[model samples]
Target: MKRSIATLFILFSITIVKAQEIDSLSFIKSKRMSDDDLAKKREGTFFTGIPDFSSDPVTGFGFGLRTNTYWNGNRDNPLFPYTPYLAKLKANAAYYTSNARELVLSLDVPYYKGTRWRFKIDFKAQQNPANLYFGLTESTLGQLRLPSDENTTFSTYREFDRARKTLRPGGVGEADFVTDALSNRFRETEYMLNLKADYALGNGKWRIMGGYEIQHLSYTTFEGMEAEAIDPITGQNTTAPNGISLLRRDFEDGLISGVDGGWVSIIQTALIFDTRDFEPDPTKGYYFEIANEYSSKYIGSQFDFNKLFIQGRAYQKLPIGKRTVLAGRFGAGNIFGNNAPFFEFQDQWSPEGSINALGGRQSLRGYRANRFLARSMWFTNVELRVRLAETQIGKQRFAFAVAPFFDAGTVRDRWQDLNFKNIKTSYGGGLRIAWNQSTILSFDYGHSKEDRLFYFGIGQAF
Candidate 1:
């Protein structure tokens, strides 16, 4: 039996309950930007689009190219009186085709010197669709972010964001200087390969998703694994649990840790779904997803984590008004394992970091980046979208949409901690300009008792 754990899927199952009802423009955006990018849209969240991988399935030939830029510099920081621009560029495109025998080729190119590029192909047979489905997803990934004399930060994970969240004034701003290379830079550049397969059981309307991916994680970053661990209990942190304090965690965004060395291995079976049985409208429907995926760092990678997750989404047309629609829902999940991986965020309200509001595009709309990364958490949202304008764009009609929504949720606590009797809530509205049958540009602002924020994104929050 594979030694892999079931943490990922386990949490997936529990959260399986939550859902999304993606509509028109936003629907397409969610698919393109993907769960990963949507999540990154949140402040303080890790820029996991690092490898720029697409979680959606692929079976045909198509090429896509995207370039992303990140410019961040504070005017108040004394590190360098002059605010400098921190720029990042990422672009990717892929093509794929298949033969009856299950053969495919995929080429991915990413130019940003801070990420990775990949090419993938697969071959297998659908011997028995009745009870077994076997296939392969093989991939080769190369480095895009190579180290340069001017570039020094090794790991750009949330850990760095939290550490840099606050600036302490000493005799000179030089106090926050990077004297050690490993602790300051993300410098590894390497290649990797991954293989995967899946099988599922049907339970009437619901078909559980379970599969595995074998991965080879061999890359370098400016930082090392021994850096520091964000205190889940007290946002305050120490570099070495017993020796030194590395960088302080930032509660506004979220916190993340860094790792070094490389390991490759097979992840255990997880879950997935084919919501066709639940809804028919490809643009607006009701369905859910759950997973308990698990994998090791590298083949011989040091620490391993097991994770569990579950989520659900649904939508329908309402008679409230013209071009008016109602869609949205709630989601909850948990993580458990010897060393389960988690999204970290220094909670300003809590100080210490425990898995709480892993804020992302999917969870909290007004927050900036991983406003609150959490290991154990709950996320919820309710939206009513309406299309006001109708015009043709190219081969498709364009639409202007407005959605009034209420979002309420919390993290780290069990259901009991959340009082259905009384909950923390936020209200907001947004506008969207849609093109063709596929794209959208949205601006949503939400306000709550804690904070009020604005969100400008490519697609829908569903």
Candidate 2:
């Protein structure tokens, strides 16, 4: 949920049950539909309720159901040709095998009731038992070589340390403890509420956006390895081994705060200019936005911070071939104010909403989600999309395409320290399924120096 709605696993099932697009990233229109195409469009409410199932590396396997309803009204409506859907209501209840869970409800409306305004509201309760923390920024990458020597496993180190503690008792001569990859695991539970509104300028090409968001986040750090007395009767150690998690160590060292969690309330505004031919799967035109977010005590926020992000995306149809296009995006963001919470460093927000920065499917793709976190960051994505075929399925339009992409980014502890030096990169390709000109099912595999990741998502990454 830290990124666009496309990153949500529930979208996999929702897209399968029905086809529609209604979110921050999809609202503008740049092309006019022909009379014949408009005549074939469907009107009225489209409703569907079905069992939902999905599998992914982060959430494991999940099963649930969603109530998805769309109201498109008549083609005569002024917004019909411009908006993906006139209005939408979607609700979900689900559980994952990894002990993760979710309860969410969302609503979106564009050109509200013939007006020039757009509105969206979302509520969610999410639990991530496998949340990750890699110690922040480029430094975390070095930790992948933990234990130093190839022959030393984390388990052997822990056993040896336990023996040393048992022999030394409380003596100061004991060796300093060490942690490995498993130490990055933690638990996070969040309750979030978001409300957004957008007003169009005279030509409906420029927009002013405003929003409010609040989140209650709680975390559970790992329990460290402890020494225990041997059982007198059984003559065996009765305690289990546990190593201190990176999150716990950071809290103790004062590297991070708010372990118990608190309120993060923010007010956001942005100026956006868009001229995409299609919002869901843009084939031409450009989009730009500059967004600002402020969080302060006066806004009921327990943490204070000011963030600014500027981004641009462009799509061009390649003249070399039919149905071939080139798409590219570039973004840079920085957070000001010393009181910004650690979690805020992982995200970059715009009128299109937050995308996990520096890494992850929406950003670098090859790196793990939020593998790098810092106060300032920059990234770019470029992809070549070529349509392979198209067909009509019982009045529904379907098309398939293949996209080869490249991603790169870097992060810095401070905006003043930003540089291109140590940039991380990912290269990959994906298959895209366009359903009814709105929904897209995307499958991608990415590779980087540290990890290889596969992403199955609903819509274009931008």
Q: How far is candidate 1 from the true structure (C-alpha RMSD, Å)?
A: 19.2
Candidate 2 TM-score over all chains jointly: 0.80
Tens-digit lDDT string for candidate 2 (152-196): 222232343333223212212222432233355678889999998
- Model 2 lDDT, residue 339, Cα: 57
Candidate 2: regions farther than 4 A off: 1-41, 48-55, 65-68, 141-181, 224-240, 320-322
Model 2 accuracy (lDDT, Cα): 0.71
Q: After superposition, how far is residue 194 of candidate 2 from its true place, in Å?
A: 1.0
The alpha-carbon RMSD values of the candidates against the true structure, listed in the order shown, are: 19.2, 9.2
- In model 2, the Cα lDDT at residue 34 comes to 33
Superposed Cα deviation of residue 441, candidate 1 (Å) = 3.4
Top candidate by TM-score: 2
- Total clashing pairs for each candidate: 83, 1
